[model samples]
Target: MVRSEWTKVWTTPGTAWLLITMVVATAGVSVLAAAVTGCPDTGCTVDVAKVNLTGVQLGQAVVAILAVLVVGGEYSSGMIRTTFAAVPRRLTVLAAKALIVTGVVVVTAAIAVAAALIISARLLPLSLGNGTVLRAAGGSVLYLGLIGLLALGVATAVRDPAAAVGAVLGLLYVFPIFGLATTDPDFQRHLQQIGPMAAGLAVQATTGLDTLPISPWRGLAVLAAWAAAALLAGGLLVRLRDA
Candidate 1:
């Protein structure tokens, strides 16, 4: 089942194109950001790691769309019914898609993040040996992977490509906008603590850790929890609804 899903993902040209675009968009934005930003000889307080990985903010959208298409496309094309018929166990099918989608997204993200780091190394004072930088880089990759899983689960539950994409994007981008619009600091902080994008991206912070609403690792855990819950809900819904 996993092999079948893997083949389906690679055979799709749009998915491949999006993966390439993810790498380019991520690396390109990082380069642009690093070019404009600077640090002093005395060392700066700016979170250089986060700045260099800034392209991730855009790259994640692509990841979310691709993940949505993974399942939603099947539903749109009426292939999901055939998939369910062949697999018999609906949960197994979701698991397979989740595994394949997460695996591919993580690997592609690793490449994209590495490319961003390597290209921005000269523009920024990036140290490969620095543990903080390492953690930020590693965490950013995991962040994109988790975003993919979250989108996949949403697509599974929604079963509509356009609506699923909108829903996931709202969780990622819109929620933060709402947080920013809020007047209450406490409510805003609470929103960041639970928001998938805001919390997940916190893992990329290498400085000003004292001010973060949630710690880096803890923020990533928050995103993981969101993904897990989404998948659980999607699994139940998939079983309850007809393809």
Candidate 2:
């Protein structure tokens, strides 16, 4: 069943393109970010990992689209019926899809994140491969993988490509907006601590941990919590709803 799901994903058109886009878009944008933000002097204070890895802000949207199309596209075309016919266990089907999507996104995001880290690290004079730098680099890859899982859950729940894509992007962005709009400092800090984007990106901070709303690994755990909740909800819905 898992292999069958994997084959279905690879056989689909635009799958390869989206994966390539995630890698290329991440690497290319990160290169530009590093170039423009490159330390021209010894006193610059940019968060080196965060600076180059900012491309993830763009790459994740592509990841969302890729994930949406994986299962949601099947529903839009009525192919899910065929899928259900082949695999009677709906949760297993979703689990397979989740694994395949995570695998692909992780591989592509790893390549993109590694290239971005190397290129961005070069732009700064700071020594690389510290624990913080390694965490930022490695966490960015895991972050993308989590984004893929979240998207899969949203798409499975929504079951419409357009709606699922929109919902995923909205989920990714909306809380950040809320976090920024309020005037109360305490509330604002709490908002950022919980917002998926704000908190998850904390792992990319290499220099300003003292000022961040949440700790790096803790923030990532927040995003992981969100992903787990999404997958659980999606899994239950897939089993309860008729294909």
- Backbone-clash count (model 2): 0
Segments of candidate 2 deviating more than 4 angstroms: none
**Candidate 1: misplaced stretches above 4 Å?**
40-43
Cα lDDT tens digits, model 2, 112-227, are: 88877777667654456688888888899999999999999988988999999999899889987886788889998998889888889898899879989999999999999988
Q: How many clashes in each candidate? A: 0, 0
Model 2 error, position 197 (Å): 1.1
lDDT (0-100) at residue 238 of candidate 2?
A: 89
What would the C-alpha RMSD of candidate 1 be, to one decimal place? 1.4
